[model samples]
Structure formats: structure tokens, C-alpha cells
Target: MRQTPDCVLDRPSVDDLDQFFSIVSDPRVWTHLPSGRLTDEEEAEAILVRLVFADRGLTAAQLGARLA
Candidate 1:
């Protein structure tokens, strides 16, 4: 886990959905990404689920370390 003066860098989890949604739902946050800002909570939820739980071959700890 890395900590800067302003924030900590770590793997995100399901519990972080609300905070994650708050950030990504903002239009400015998606300006450089391939897609536009998420339109609603349901959309955000689906995306987060796939990202955190889908079988991408990495174990949870491996995923967390890479993300961190």
C-alpha cells in the first residue's frame, strides 16, 4: 500500500462502489477514457462487478497487488 500526502493507493473493493461511482460519474473523469461517463448507478455496479470478480486469471491478492 502506498500513501501520498493526499490519498492512498490501493486495490479497490466492492465496498468502494459508492465512492468509485462518485468519481467516475463525473463527466470530467471520463474525458480521456474510451467511453463517456457512466449514466447511472446500475451501469457503474455492473462494470465494477466484472472488473473485480470476473475470472481474469489473477488471484485476488495478485490482482490487488497489481492494482496497488
Candidate 2:
């Protein structure tokens, strides 16, 4: 997690499944997404699982890493 005075930013994990589903399933969010919004909780969970595992090899700091 990264925190500044204004807010805290966290990486997506299984713990955020509900919030992730709520945002992605919203109609407004769907309109802007080419893949469209999530269809159901199960689908959201699957996606989140993939996301969580996909990030397992990286750290938050490395998200901004570059070659020197």
C-alpha cells in the first residue's frame, strides 16, 4: 500500500473482490470498457484471481521501475 496525505493506494488482491465487482459491474464503467463490464460475481472472482496471481511476481515499487 502507498499512502500520501490525501489517500491510500493499494494493489488489487482477493480481499478487494467485492469492491472490484461493484465498480466493474456498473453500467457507466461498462460503457467505457471495450470488453464490457463484468457479468456476474463468479466472473468477477475469476478475473480478480487472475489479477492477484498475475501481480505475484512484482512489487508495488517495481510497478514504476525502469532501466537505468
Candidate 3:
């Protein structure tokens, strides 16, 4: 895990889904992301699932490529 004075960076888990969704659902957060802000809970859940799989070698980029 990496930390700075303001925040810490670490792997995300199922428990973080709500916070993750809250953050990503905001349009400001999508300024550099490939997709636009998520419009619903279902889409956020789907993205969270892919992120969890990404930690286990699937890689988010690979998942995004397939999604694209």
C-alpha cells in the first residue's frame, strides 16, 4: 500500500463498492476515464466486479479493451 499525507492507495474490495460507486458516479471523476459517468447502480456494480477481477491478474486495461 502507498500513502501520502492526504490519502492512501491500496487494492479495492467488495466492501468498497459503495464508496467506489459514489466517487465514479460523479461526472468530474470521468475527466480522464475512457467511459462517461455511470448512470446507475447496475453499471457501477458491473465495473466494481471487473475491478475485483483485475486485482487477480485479469488487468483492468485488458477488461476495458474487451469491453470496448
* lDDT tens per residue, model 1, 1-68: 79999999976767879988998798788778837688789888767755776545666677667757
lDDT of model 3, residue 52: 82
Ranking by lDDT: 3, 2, 1
Cα misplacement distance, residue 65 of candidate 3 (Å): 21
TM per model?
Answer: 0.60, 0.71, 0.63
- lDDT string for model 2 (1-68, tens) is 99999999999888998899999888887776747887789999877876776577754455335212
Best by TM-score: 2
- Superposed by TM-score, candidate 2 places the C-alpha of residue 36 at a distance from the truth, in angstroms, of 1.1
Candidates in order have lDDT scores of: 0.76, 0.77, 0.82
Candidate 1 total steric clashes:
0
> Looking at model 2, how many pairs of residues clash?
0
Local error of candidate 3 at residue 23 (angstroms)? 1.5
